[model samples]
Target: MAISCSFFLFMVFTMMDHHVGGHENVCEELRCGGKGPAIRFPFRLSHTRQPDHCSFPGFTLSCTDSNQTLLELPISVKLFVEEIDYISQVIQLSDPNHCFPIELRRLNLSSSPFQFLFHEQDYYPRGYGLFNCSQSTDQRNGIFRISCLSGPTHQVYALDLNDGQSLMELPISSCTKMYNIPYVPEMGDANILHLNWSTPDCRHCEQRGENCRILKNNNSTDESKTECFPRQRNHAKGRTSTKLEIVGAILGSFLLVLLVFAIYRVYRYDKVEKENQAKIEMFLEDYRNLKPSRYTYSDIRRITNEFADKLGQGAYGTVFKGKLSNEIYVAVKILNTSKGKGEEFLNEVGTMGTIHHVNVVRLVGFCADGFRRALVYEFLSNNSLDKFISSADVKNQFLGWDKLQDIAIGIAKGIEYLHQGCDQRILHFDIKPHNILLDQNFNPKISDFGLAKLCSKDQSAVSMTTARGTMGYIAPEVFSRNFGNVTYKVDVYSFGMLLLEMVGGRKNTEVTKENISQVYFPEWIYNCLEQKEDFRVFVEDDGDAHIAKKLAVVGLWCIQWHPLKRPSMKVAVQMLEGGDNLIMPPNPFATTATTRTNARIPAMDFRQELQVIPESE
Candidate 1:
């Protein structure tokens, strides 16, 4: 009976070894068109060519009917596989049809396991950023134009990714920027894109010029381990490799019995936290070399004195008056965001770090200790421009017409700097009276960049999915693309609304039911200008009236319903300086022209001649 049992066990063991070996043969390397790279373990063919457990997560590839391998990435990006170096765990991709450039606007590799691979000839380590500009935009040195994305309407360009700079520093003005892009990929080969995987890394095997194979599978954890293996032509006949696999299986089973399911849960939780942390740390790393000082949460408490003097509150965060020292005071805004990777927080830090203008608020420092984020700003004693411009009752506090004109120029210059002074363009989507702070001398400083966006100067128009800025101050194009594809004109429109509020000394949205007919300044102001009537606000002399009218005309030009009719900030600043041949802009309120008692304005929607006459002419 013992002899019979031993013989039976020997037969069972032989059958089990053959069964496992046959399964490994089934998952053997596959190729496309008989010339493509070998796709084996850690990368399996899609559509049931192999089991899901055979490949690492996010490593599935498909074979096209044309006998080519296709890789679909996050954000609907697709690339044709050119080659795969299994040893190095690197993949080479190409775009023969040139469709990759358009897909780049939607490409984000964060969800994928692969990252861009750098070449020896590549100038920028991370990747090149994309910018779509109009054909009229002047060309720049060291920048390459991507013709595949270019059309009669606009052209696309790529900028090098420097250590601490962005495409917004592109030094070409009058390029007529449109939409913004956020792409990071290797350059030097216009037709090729290279990416590398970290998981299942075969560095040891690669250094030794040998193949690596997944030998052990932790069934409960769904994990696998890769090890270097000697080159073998006949894998099934390799008894040494088979013996190693048997030993690995025995060890894997022993480890599986000792590990609990809860360990996996902890691993998954830790993985998610690490991913989130990696994203925040990556953003901070980009801005690390910038001038703004990084602070700890403990330092924030010491500076604010435990949130002692609250200055104000808004959608983004709350501001507190704090002292950097006895002589220097600062306004610290504790961001009201639990998401450290929030768009608002990143925007404030990213855009403000590079900006330095007299009329723009300074970023003193920032706090990013354990997700507790805060932005320290230069304190202005006079509060915001809204405090003085909101009501007309404060006679002593009101800035005179001359002072207001100077402030307007200062504001215009600031906007001009944001538009043209920087190498790239930065749009303040939430430009309003409240965002303009007042220094002790009442000089205006642009603040609140929670809604800011940075882009190349030469790109084309943008179509925003959501509206930005205060309701009354938001550009018409922001709400609807019918106002023309939204772009920098949105800022021009917000600037117009701000200028009108400055002249009227009231909010555009402060109308109540009791004063509905008597109030509503925008329409009322338009009527006064058309009917040759004096404004209700007090004016000292003819110069005040002239200054008010000039501001109104520039404001009117900026608030045009059609974006093409609005002046660029550069042109608006010149208009404010009284040199440009200014004209009363065709009324944007033409939809209400038929109901008015006396009105004369053209109803022409000049889409064909889509160009702003103010800045360009």
Candidate 2:
């Protein structure tokens, strides 16, 4: 019984030691305690800890060795955590030193991701000490230039660490020319620490109980301050010396303990990272079956040819121009890792994969390699509709009265197809000129089906919790149902805005003071028809006044405020093609504020309106 009890106690002690040693092993491997000040997470050593998430992955800390207690990140960036406010979710870090070959002073401010935490404070430059060096006087006394600029001028230097490297480089001449000294009292003689000095400061020497002396060089005019070396005290010979050695050992032991703890943290971080990669790979494998095709990161590099030519960027991704084969050109859209909407990518790919339409841009293929997701589409030479209509010079060349009418008709037909032609009704939440791409022949192709939603064909409109679509072009029903219940007619409202823009040769909302008072443009177009006046904003030699009147009438017919009153896309297409004598549209902006509020239209039953037929038929 005695032997068994002894063995059990030994096993328990061994288990305790093993657990404690596991943490110590990590600390020792990293050597974090010896490096510098140790900072741990719920904290990060750098601002960019991981791809998108703000805080460091695994909430690990870093330990570094410097005058400032710096935390070295896994990415090899060293940061000084000045303050951490848990309540505000803010961390203030000191400006990093620039030691690279590149003139890092400029790069520090612009390149570094660290942002200022203070609401209104601005960053400034670091100040240097200035001293008046004369041959007669000992080069010790000097003025510290703390606050130089007093008036309304901005603060040129900041004392807070949040300032970053805005003012990193101190002027070398500032030490001599400004006749100023640093606020730190231990910085011996200012002259020795000055740009021209060769020796150390004497005030530091005096603090160590050494005499201050001056060294003069034959070729140099400036005098350098030097300190007399101190003799070491022998503990065996004195009682005071013995006490100091014991105290030194105690401090050293404390530092050793901290160092061991730091190293353990780093070791644990490496192990965790490896485990995380393995789990991510397994998760991706499961997702791969659902994804159409798996492209390697190497394949992406080969396809993009090292991101040779960047097309443009948008909210979700960056576009790159690349050739898939000898004859085929494709636009590669690389999803930004910072955007946390991975589900949206899957939605767009899955939806577009099943869709094939002449007026819609085709998705050739896609790439899902780890965190790097991309989509490949057939390249459109003419870019987007915004390029042509938005430009003052280009709008006339590609978009004339004839072509604009054809484009408008084509767009309406396309939306009509999505509503009734497809197996499922696809609600394009965003409809604007920007989303409309043009082919080589100036044909409008609806692009960017990212915000699309698939609903039943029988439903007149799908209930939406959040409002979507571009401002100004959005239907009145979307903001308030006083206009009408939300339906696909919202698209008609946007189509109306686009039609008006095409007719006016510019955006209708962009009316200037020169034109605002003189019959609000859309209203003016309506009044002109009422009086049978010529409707022409731009009267060039090639312009057709009759065609302009037809487009204005069709645009007014589409934007009737109430979805019930607005024409369907099929009707809109017929109206665009129809000659004059189309029925007059009701005034859209005539509703009184009181009546609009009181008689608000309730939620729509999409089934009832889904059977709408073209009125022209």
Candidate 3:
């Protein structure tokens, strides 16, 4: 039983070998005949039916029913395969263009898997040859050559199957002048035009006059047939040679597939790398042109001490204190990721990079590492101006009459610089006391340029859609502009409110019981001045009355209802510095609040009502 099983297994193995060997005869159908050349190996007839080794993945070849072949690439590219030579291993293709003249040339063998069969030792004794071709307007042609050292004599040639005459001919040397050759047996004589050389002795077998035969097959008649040939015959026998050829073809196909895959992967990797490099280059270009200091995320971590202490928080980011190597302190702001305000951050960085003024807060550096965005600013020890004036307790401690005036002037100068000093005029859309920071010397520096907008200096007024300034500080035209068009006077209005806050040592909207009737404090001050009543309550000291009056007049001038009526920061700075007590302002509350006549009549009516109550008593 064991011997029988072994015989059966041997028979099965023999049958399997016969089946495997028979698959090589599955000849591919050939379709040829066209004005152009027939498309062959290295490229298949269809993108889907291509040989596994012929094309790269995602890259395919298409042979149209009209006989034109096409190479499909990732990026849009169209090429027509004009000619292909199986013997010379070269292809000719034409570039389609309109204005540019189209020319035909040999396919770049180096770029493809095909190699020219050359005698290496004879053609290139040392190395390859490099050449240059120049075309002259005078129709002059230039030629240059390099000689081989020592080997068998060989000549450069190409196979032309299209002519149907000589199978071998010298290649038409037009533009290309560089080539490398390899050494082999009489490669020059074995051409399509002539077949004279004989096959050499088999390297593996020393048999004198051996022949090929089909050793095994399903049909006994086909298997019995065998043919022999002379040793001098150029071609080998059909069966044995076909088997070797099929095996070599399969191995070559695999190598071609691997080469194509490698090329595609390299191309894709390079393309992605280029795209990322382009993004980085674009960012760097903007940085270099804008002169913004870029910081890495790790640098930010060191500077902010891993975000140890928080200074404050806003809707979009948080501010942290950091110390630089110079021992100079800075406030680092880390922006929130969810907030879609990266454009605003970039604008602020771009604008601040070009601006350098004593009254403007300095931008120290910035970070834009993946997912992390931060801005570093020079630390202001005194913090925001709102800290001093908004809170009642801290107001008197920092903001004296003289100090307030100086701060007002400094802030005015800063706004003026933004409006005029820069190449482009900048508008602070959200100007308020909270946006102003004070230095060590109590000098008010305009901060938070995040909302600043750039406009051409030549333009008189900037067009705005939505109002951005603090509610109370926003200009009247910005809300109801039927009165007139809004302009830089918007900033003027905010500056006016800031000036009032400075002078009053408090916010203009005082919530005291005595001033409940006076909803608008500026109007209340106006009514007092109109009534010729003493406006001494707001005066901090009798000695500083002159300063007080100047501030009041300047504030009133800036708060004019119409944008055109309001003074520019340039003029306001002059007015504040000149220390001039100008004319009293018009009744700004006349349109909304009751007049002095009506107010007096109300008081008189109340008194009359009190007198009438006597009868009930």
Candidate 4:
């Protein structure tokens, strides 16, 4: 028995010794490639290594085909890492595209783990502007122009965006699209930019031959702080001191207890993760016949570079720019965990996988690893339609009226296809300008199936427990059952609102500086059509006038006060494509505020009463 006890003690001591040696070895050895500064600690190679091997999350590096190390930034930027100074915690970066001026105007480090080397450069308090010009200007205007990128027909200029003199010389009207960014010049190579990062100041302490340790918060008074001290300063003087031996044993025992606790916690975490994974698997079993690929959580993080470049954010999740391959880029939307029963995630994957229309965004893949969920979509260069029309200076960015008419026809066809073409009916509960994504050719595609519902094509009406849609575009029947049972006409109503916004060049319900009766844009258009006005906003000729009038007439017909009065999406498409004269319907809104309130209250009350009734047993 005595021999066995001593053997057990020896085994424990050996394990502790091996653990300490392993930690020291990890710090001493540097990870290196064929050339360049050896990377250690913070910066690690992602996918090729385990997360536990890295000191931090965002400090990951990837190797290029040419053996050069690359670091992707938060703004879809690719930077070649020229040098990494561990002592100073600075990384020297250069643009691989060799367009430093363009990069300087677009670089944003606010949400990143690093910042510009502020002390080395002449910092400008004002923001810089990147002007995309159609023709070169002979005037110097005190702005630094990128001559390498300039050509006879196209020129790019960089100047202080906020400078009154610069603005006067180069007005925004002259440029195609101007980009404003924080101005910070580089130190040595004008082409190279330097960024410094904040990390544990261990290099200085190690250089001074002192030991650094992370102090734990015992009473929760002080947060975790790194302290540097002499390794031998706290040593006991006497070799024969029994107190020292007792203290050593107690400390070693405490460490063993902590190690055991860590192992147990890891086991519990793995169990929970497995359970969640099972749930996701079971939920997606119904979609096995679908075409879209399923991705794991690690796959999602790798695809998005840890959510580095955010494209946009909506109520459900934030979208990030991702690349599946060198030639295939995708938009990965990481769904919020707060969503109920994963229905939204299921809806997006199910509805989009079956859809293959020119005007519908395609789903490339999806991630359903445990609680981490993400939907991958084909990347569209032109982004959403709202960006074009909502811009205050729309002349430069917005496509002309002829193109707008094409986009309207394309959208109407997409809606028509959704109602009639699909084997099972898909109700796009949300159909607004924001959801209408545009492609490179100014073609509009309807996106966002988070609120979409699937029903049989034979069913005329869809049952809903709650109102689903954006406030401005929701149909009246969706808000209240008294107007009518919810049908595909709801989408038609939303499409009509979208059409009016496209025609009027503003929102349908937005109060503008026009006459009080014309504050609502659709009402103003109705008054114009009623009076036989020329429909003069951006109408250069007779053809433009006819297209504008057609769009307005169709919009009014689809937004009638009652669901039965509104034309179906199929009929609406016909009016847009054919040369049939559209007769405007009755006004959807009341003339007085009191009358409007009275019209809305009774229907809203009926919906409330219907919502209270329980399902039949």
TM-score per prediction, in order, is 0.49, 0.46, 0.47, 0.49
lDDT of 1: 0.74
lDDT of 1 at 40: 71
Task: Return whichever of 2 and 3 wins on lDDT.
Answer: 3
Q: Which ten residues in a row have the lowest lDDT in candidate 3?
A: 608-617
> Which pairs clash (backbone N, Cα, C closer than 3 Å) in model 1?
132-459, 133-458, 168-424, 169-423, 170-423, 177-459, 178-459, 178-460, 178-461
Candidate 3 deviation (Cα RMSD): 27.2
Instruction: By lDDT, rank the candidates, best first.
Output: 1, 4, 3, 2
Clashing pairs in 4: none
Which candidate model has the greater lDDT, 2 or 4? 4
Question: Can you write out model 4's per-residue Cα lDDT over 1-617, one digit (the tens) per residue?
Answer: 33554565677667655543333323221343668656555676654533443345467777787878888888888888989876677889878887676676657777778876755344645566667787666545446566656778877777666567866676457677556656534421267777877754456765776554444344655432455557453332432254456558857876676677668768788888899898778756743444788899898888888889999887788999998744578899999998778889988988888887889888888988888899998888889988776642356765777888899999999988888888887889899888889887888999999888877776657777899887667888988877887887889888988887777777544544564444356777877887887544677788878888888888877776567777777778888988466655655676446445544322211111112222111
lDDT of 2 by residue, 115-186 (tens): 323224324433333332221222222222222221243222212223233223333233233222112111
Error of 3 at 293 (Å): 0.8
On lDDT, the leading prediction is 1
Question: How much does candidate 4 score in TM-score?
Answer: 0.49
Model 2 weakest lDDT span, ten residues long = 189-198
Question: Residue 437, candidate 1: how far off, in angstroms?
Answer: 0.5
